[model samples]
Target chain A: MGRWEPNATDRLVVAALELFETNGYENTTVIGIAERAGLTKSTFFRHFQDKREVLFGRSSLADVLAEGIAKAPADAEPLEAVACALELLAQDVFTPERRDFIARRQAVVATHPELREREALKGLGLIAAMTGALERRGLPALTARVTAELGALALELAYTRWGSASRDFTEVAREALDEVRSAAPAR
Target chain B: MGRWEPNATDRLVVAALELFETNGYENTTVIGIAERAGLTKSTFFRHFQDKREVLFGRSSLADVLAEGIAKAPADAEPLEAVACALELLAQDVFTPERRDFIARRQAVVATHPELREREALKGLGLIAAMTGALERRGLPALTARVTAELGALALELAYTRWGSASRDFTEVAREALDEVRSAAPAR
Candidate 1:
């Protein structure tokens, strides 16, 4: 039977988060992070290009969301397709156990302008991923783009609240999406 | 009678765009940009925080857009307030005479990942500006946020199309807004 094994990347993320919080993000170094994670600097570079990327964790979220959007029911509306993907993210990406890490990551990014800029750019990429995924489902390009924009806003709100909301991330995301859809006027 | 005088900031932008395009972004430097513009390196730093900031200009766009949104008719809808601001931008910020510089800046940014990241984050700021302005007009927070997202998309599309569209930027922006509105569903 397969047993749990240590992941160098996860170890690096945990170490980086702690160091970034305690020593301040600007004061933290890649070598320091690697040492804290019980690995070498080269091992750290192998996992992440830089310290800033440790919190982003590559492009897995986009892949997960795209796969979920593609798997949505055929009769689903444009936003519904996005909703399906968000639910997947809540259940898988934003699991209860990872809430603390995600919250800590948000806090670190919030205080650092450089991290905030990177996070904002990362958000644009997620929107692009969602838009492209929806287009592959045969939705009109504008419809897909618009839905993705709204979905990104909802996703952003959910991420901000996931750290402290009383309800689960799933419920928060659903409410966020509803709030977005309510404000969006019908054609 | 007043005579036209050179603006150091404008000269720097022109020089930066040319250098970024010809010498490549990475190879270009503040000294080179200043020399190309016939200004001192100190002058360049005085005008911009860095080379990337030169391409983005100051926070004038946000201020202009916010002011425009505030000046919209009292009865204007949330998106209409955004539209009014866009029209003002087209007339003032994205005027025909500045189209070439703006287009070149866009091309230069498209070629550089660093510049694109800066541009993306700047976009978030614009969305924030629009949202706050809409809220000031008495729109609900969610309504303002959602409209700003849609409006930001339209503004992005308009900016991309501004250089070569047969119509003017103002018309382009208006049409872009209409396209966004059409795709958005009525409440």
Candidate 2:
């Protein structure tokens, strides 16, 4: 049987979040995070370039979303296709157990205006990725861009709702999509 | 007959754009911008807190948009109300001559990452205003927030498309809204 073992990267991320919450982001240092993680500074550097990367590091969520969109049925409508992709990520990437980490990460990012901007950039990156995937699926550029943005919008709203810790993320996402569809005028 | 005259604020904005484009944003000093505008440094300070404010200064667009939403007919749906507000701002706030300044401001903001974040924050501010307006109209908090965000997304996309300097901003915005509505699944 496989035993649970935290890798260097996971250890660093956990340690960084703990220190950031306890000492504040500005007061927390790279050296302190590394020491708390029981790893050398070089090991920390090998895993992340700086303290910010602990929060901003590439996660499988982006990959899963992009891959899901790219591999969706070719005949699916654009927005439906985007929703399918997001649902796939919700199922595969954002599990119930990861809730604590995601919550802590959001709290840390919320504490600083600069970090919030970086978080915004990350959101923009997801939209851009989804846009590119839709474009590759033969959607027109403008349509793809708008549809991707809407999909990202749904994802964000769902994440916010799911933050309450009462329901599954996928269920929240499905309800969020329904809310968006209801909000708009029928075509 | 009425005569055309550029006021101090307008002169400073034009001068700041010129200096930012010509001398690069980092190298362009406030004094240089004021000198180019044929205004004293004190006059520049009277208008803007700093060089960044030259591009990021508050305008009437947010006020008009929020007011439009707040004043929409009581029976109007939340998203429809948001769209109407955007349409109103498009008609009132984005005049033909203002188009040039907006385009230049966007270009300057695009060249620098920091400025882009500031620009994004400005966008967030608009969304917050719109959300508050929707809340005033009795929409639920999450629904208002999501609807406002979608409106902001449409505005950003339309603004980007309108930067080409050919069509009226209102027309571009209308088309952008149409694109979003059409992209959603027909329920």
Highest-scoring model, lDDT: 1
Q: What is the lDDT of candidate 2?
A: 0.80
**TM of each candidate vs. truth:** 0.93, 0.83
Candidate 1 error regions (>4 Å): A1-5, B1-5
What tens-digit string does per-residue lDDT give for candidate 1 at A30-80?
Answer: 999989998888888777888899988654888888988999999998888
Q: Which stretches of candidate 2 lie over 4 Å from their true place?
A: A1-6, A40-46, A58-60, B1-9, B34-50, B77-80, B87-92
- Candidate 2 residue-wise lDDT, B1-187, digit = tens: 2233359888998899999999899999999998999888888888889989888784766898898898788999876787788778777877777787788888899999778877877887888899899999988876687678667877888888887758887788777777766665555
Q: Output the worst ten-in-a-row residue range by lDDT, candidate 1 chain B.
A: B1-10
Q: Which docking category, incorrect, acceptable, medium or high, applies to candidate 2?
A: acceptable
lDDT string, candidate 2, A74-171, tens digits = 99888778778877887786778877778888888889876887777778788888988889999987668767766777888888767666778888
lDDT of 1 by residue, B1-187 (tens): 2233379877888888899999999999999999999888887887789988998875388888898899999998887888899989988889888888788878889998888887888888999998899899888988888888888999998999988765688899999999999988445
lDDT of 1 at A28: 97
| The candidate that achieves the highest TM-score relative to the unseen native structure | 1
